[model samples]
Target: MSFRKILVANRGEIATRVVRTARALGYRTVAVYSDADAQAPHARLADEAVCIGPPPAAQSYLSIPALLDAARRTGADAVHPGYGFLSERADFAAACAEAGLVFIGPPASAIEAMGDKAGAKRRMLAAGVPCAPGYLGSDDDSDERLLAEAERLGYPLLVKAVAGGGGRGMRLVHGTHELAGAIAGARREAESAFGDGRLMLERLIEHGRHIEIQVFADAHGHAVHLGERDCTAQRRRQKVIEEAPSPVVSAAMRERMGADAVAAALAVGYVGAGTVEFIVDAGLTHYFLEMNTRLQVEHPVTECITGFDLVEWQLRVAAGEPLSAWLPNGQADIRFSGHAIEARLYAEDPYDGFKPQTGRILHWQPAHATQAGRAPGAAASSVRIDDGIAEGGSVTPWYDAMVAKLIVHGRDRADAVRRLVAAIEDSPLLGVANNGRFLRDLLQHPDFAAARLTTTRLDEWAAAGAPLLQRPAPDDACWLAAAALAARGDVPTSAPAGLRPASVAWQTIALQCGSDTRRWRVRLAGDLVEFDGGPSVQLLGQEGHRWRLAIDGVTRELVALRHAGGWHLAHQGAGFVFTEPSAAPDQRRQADPGRAHAPVAGVVAQVLVKPGDAVSAGQPLVCVEAMKMEMWLNAQAGGTVRAVHIREREAVSAGALVVELDIDTVSTVI
Candidate 1:
């Protein structure tokens, strides 16, 4: 049955992607969102939108009943799972089928078969597909039995949870001494995440490349492979960068892996778009890693290289159409064109252990860079950006922090990397912490350029003490000056005529970022402003409400507006509050000093301090679990804990104070 309307049961870029594809196929798309994503790009672009619940996934995206109700309300004939949440849940797929709606993915049986890693391995082995030698039997309680299995598998084994994917619930054991701890840790994590702590052992391939083959199938038993992707660049087993037509895979090896992947899909009687992941060792020995019975986030690179919409194909396949009918099977038909690379631009700080960042996307605009054949000889390279946010959108700390996916396509890998760098260098994202600079650095690195990488490369790079490329000194000074001038509403139309007397002019500017404050004094001389104890700045020009300032060698523009008792300075994609010196007394008294509050609403997994415990600045005081992700709350200042108001596993609201520290003691430490 052809679907006339589809409901995307997801959020962020993936939901946006499903809507775009569905629209192109002449199908109306319905988007379901939470309160946090009311203004998201997906909601704005969908033909119809409905608010399912609040910001939390449990109350919204992961709420099966809410999604089903939305689909029914919108008259959606099909529901696209979009990779995460209930994407691989057999019950969700079965429910959709029972509700007379297409799931737009693999069958319920296929999802169930691949959902259990151990079961999939057993199936793969029986089907003659290359499988990693490991323990998958029902008997797993005996320590001696596990030890014997580990010895047979050799040292450096991976203990993986049967019901886990993504890098969660897995532990690596290098020796027998660490085997039990690794197993226990993996079991604990698995139980906490999937509610099933069942684990299996496998021989670890120390320098293996993560390769995955895309497979498409129809209900009529016809299936074909759409080449391969290299997702070796990762951190904690989560992919960071992905590319199509892996640089490491030879044409012959590609054919072998592709055929094996197709075979694996057929073994499960799979249908629609799916991925068969594998780990290829240094010696080119490939082992099956489980299959993902849904669309992948990195599907864009494959589409770019193949010039085929996988989503469109998925829709057609779901309608019982065969693959060969769309594109005839021939040498020219199966060829991949150009190279495409995608970088997941997340709101995260790589310098701080890849901590997720959350705040408002005050300003956001893609770089105008253009490649040779991609966009002619444009001033800069043009990047294809898939994002779920717009300017002035709030990135709540409720979900994943990925702001966008920046993709670049070129005639070759080298060209793609160069274009990607140019695009990142030109992007205008401020206020929130982003890894654009780090992505650029990775693309230009010797190992990445040479394609000699593994999943652990990112962690290794971080351990090597690589410093992030800081914004040029000139640029920093320019932005600071622009912010100062913009705060005063004294934007000049042109460069200042000359210097003025410093004795008669004293401009006080107070800038507030988050809870931190900075005070500055500026002595104006004609159009030039000399900041006391800081760099000298010259007003260049003004355009509309923005003021251009030149300081130290770089030029920056800022927008100014008066709000409350402070001047709001908006620049480089961020918003800052600048207040006059005279208003400091009232502002200080009004500032909320309610201790450090929870950044997000989640269950307090652990409380690290007691009422009388002494803690140092930057020490972690609490750990919160939200959406299956763990985040630690750190102390901003050293002090004795005057009060402990929360307990382990307690549910807390965002901005709720969990601990109260003695301000007097903290001040003394400072």
Candidate 2:
């Protein structure tokens, strides 16, 4: 039966995506949001919006009761679980079916069978699927067994939570000596993160490529594979960039992997959109990783290559459609059109351990221009940007830190990389610390260009001192000149005064880039500009729309354009925006000292330190659990724990004081 309305039980970009697809399928959409997302883009885009609970995901996105109530109140006939949260929870799926709402996914039994990594591995091995050599026995005294298995599998094995996904609840053991500690840590994290302490072991394949095949099944027991994607470019096991039609995958290898994926899905009686992940070793041998029973974040790249909307197919399958025509004899030959690559634009700081960032998006502009060369009627053109937030939208810390997914398609991988680089160059976002520059750097790296990648690439890159591909543009010189001129009262005191030429003491300014500050001295002499202090700067005559600034006798042209309440200097294929009131102060301050606040709203999972206890910097003080994940709140500095305001399992708000520290001594370390 075709459902009239569907409730998207998710947040952020995926929620908006489901709603858009539902609207296209002539179905009304309902969106449930936490307090933090009440004004989010997804809520406004839905046909109806309901406030589920507080900003914390536990009381909102992960609350089964709240979700059921929202569905009932909004008269939604079906629910679409978009990738995370309750998407793979068997209990949630069963509850939805009991409530008379269609669960647009595989059966609950299927989820339960495949949700546990150990059990899933057993089933796959039994079904003749290639699996990594490890131990997945159900013995409480399995520590000795795991150590033995680690020895046989050699050094550097992975201890993964049986019920965990993402990179959480996982630890890498380099040798037998590290096995016990890694096992204990992995179990603790597994229990804290997934509410299950069970774990298993797998051999860590060195120099492996992260590959996955998309599988679609229907109600009629029909299934088909949608080729494979190369997600080798990753950071901390989290994929940073993804592309369709892996350059390293041979046609014969693709067939073998696709066949195995189908067998795994069929073994589970799976239906709807799902991904079967695999890790391919250097020898091109593949092993089953796990199956994600929902649409993937990188589905857009597959859609771009195949010209098929996986979400639409999911809806059709849920409505009792068959996949007979899509796949003949349980397999179909897939062809790739052009190369497609996707970059996840996140509000994060790569230099700061890839920490999550949140704030209002003051400005947003995506690159939408074609490159220099292109066939007259080629399928590739400009970039196709898909985002969930607008200019005024807030990037709350209560959810995933992804701001948008930028995808670009070109005739080949080289052209695709060039287009992606151009898109990042032309794109602009302000008032938030985003990883746009980081994405550009990763794309142009020699390692990535050579396709020699693995899951540990990002961690390895960071360990080698996080190197930036490009430096901040030389636009700071223009800002220094403007500031110096303004201080002397030579330029008219007005906003946006940099646009006009001024009679200042120095038309030429010399600025030295200090360790933490920019020191400037200026001298002006009519149209003939010259500087004496520091590096000699000579001003060349300004051409139309370009400012010619000479530094150390080298003439360089720059574009001075007004932007973001200030001026933007574009030079050397890079653009840097400078504001009058620099925000350097806020960036250097310690994590808000205004009381011991909850960094994120969640139930207090554990309180490690008591009131009045002396704590040191980097000590874990509290653990907050949200969305089935545990986040440790550490001490910002050494001090006496003056107060423990919140109890165990107590729900707290973002920035709400959970602990107070009395600092006896101040250290100059931030």
Candidate 3:
């Protein structure tokens, strides 16, 4: 039953991954893309490509009819929904089957059973699987009853949507004071994300480690577990970094978790690649959180450790192959060789609440010597990068912000972390803001190195105002900018005409970054540049964006890229930006004192204040949702709302005016 052609019904890196495996299996591949992804890498990699619809996911990737029509036209006999979008939708899977196309995933019934968090927990309880203590009862149909249930669960707990995955429609309630707000917000978000507002409760396991087992099954009714991955490094309940063969899991715990994961998968008569997720508490007690009924974003780490392509297994299993043919001895005593860690390179600003960024990627470079698509060797320092976008690609606000997944392999955990750090040091993504530096910082933290990571670690770091979150000093920024400009031939070629190198007057240079603006008086003479009353700088040479230079007898290499009429620099896993002061956008803000603009690019989820309404200082004027998180736009000062410029659910760019206030009437014009 091997298929002749397969239609990939997903986008980004996962799409490319599925195509790669299909090509290896000697199958023709068809790729479907939206208007925004017309020129994306995955589109070009496939043998045949078709335009699905617009940029919004609902009209394109998530539309089952569009996908079936595309498959029908392309003569594709099978459809591979790689990870997101329609990957986990039971209706989509059923539709694929109804269209006579092989769906390379679990059965529709399995997906439906596990898709609902409350139903899944009930099934797990019936099967004797250890799940977190909470209220998933069907009797609590009212919000007031749910609040009563939360009160019984005590102070700290989570309100999660029954049909939601990925933290969307999820909220944390610290106490009774926040329960109502948490429930309402969680419900709204759940309804918006999953089309269902039904929620369940769980006692928040403080400092818990997220671990999941990779399980596989086939139409032959055989299933096996391929070890586990630790995804404890998280922020806002979303995983930031993941590693396989968890450092904290012993051999005994691994076996127990694997058995439990296999049992959970078998309970629903599962098939294809699936993951069973669990939360491990401080005392090593584990509880089932949920099961993802498709391939995971962190599957590469597991592949790096096991040397088996999970996508290939997916395709093979769908072709009616038995699980024993792929998994060693039906996954009994599965062996794991090396350690691997994956870092998700997202287009978001780590410094600004990790807000999603939308812009054209002017430059993109992965930090690995070996190119992607090749299997990493057994050496401890092998690197691999799997990405969906390339240079000149755009990151829009319509989908997930992840640009790529950087994975590194090693013989052990320490070696893997070291290699990962080295790889992260060289990765440079320009044009849009990203969290690369923040991830590198977290990797090197003493607490992380000592295996102290947890679901709450990132929040703790933010609350403590960790120094790693700060940008580089202004002096360092100027030095790097000067060197980059010199390397790119942007500096002056000659000294002052009337004086020797030592007697020339300093040239004035203005630089602006983020909010701060600084002016540095500098002099450029050949490869030697001297700042006013500062040390002389020297630019040795440049290889791509990596620059080598000596400042005051010290040598260092820095990653620098020119974009948006300025230079973006990274050193020691910290990023900084420098542009001519005039290029700063503050002038626009200063031009209109009464305008309240969108702080970040996102969809306006709600408008809290209306026109002609008086608002107090710090009162929320609007709430914008971006990067899967919501942020409030507050009034700078007490004023009467003059006009509302944007509507709810409307997309707004950074600095786009959302509201205008009557500033002069609230105060004095002076």
Task: Give per-residue CA lDDT, model 3, range 180-215, as digits (tens).
Answer: 888888888887777788989999998899999999
Please, what is the TM-score per model? 0.80, 0.81, 0.91
Candidate 1 lDDT (Cα, 0 to 1) = 0.76
| Candidate 2, lDDT over the whole model | 0.74
Q: State the lDDT at 88 in candidate 3.
A: 81
Q: Write the per-residue lDDT of candidate 1 for residues 1-670, one digit (tens) a residue.
A: 7779999999887888778878867889999999978889889889999999987676888888999999999899999898777898898999999999998999999999999999999899998889877887475545577778898889888888888877767877879999986776677667765667888888877889999999888888878888999999987677889998799999999999988998999999999999999999989889999898998888877877776777888888888777777766632376687888888887876766676667766556565532111212112233677777787787767767677888887888988888787666556465566777677778887888898888776776676766533321123443465445643354345534442223346776666544445677777665566778877777677654455777755776555444455554544333445544455354445323328688666677778899888788777888876534567787777777888889886777767888888754434332
lDDT of each: 0.76, 0.74, 0.82
Taking the tens digit of each residue's C-alpha lDDT, what string does model 2 give over 119-170?
A: 8989999999999888775766378777777787787888888887866678
Task: Give the Cα error of residue 417 in candidate 2, in Å.
Answer: 0.5
Residue 572, candidate 3: Cα error in Å is 2.7
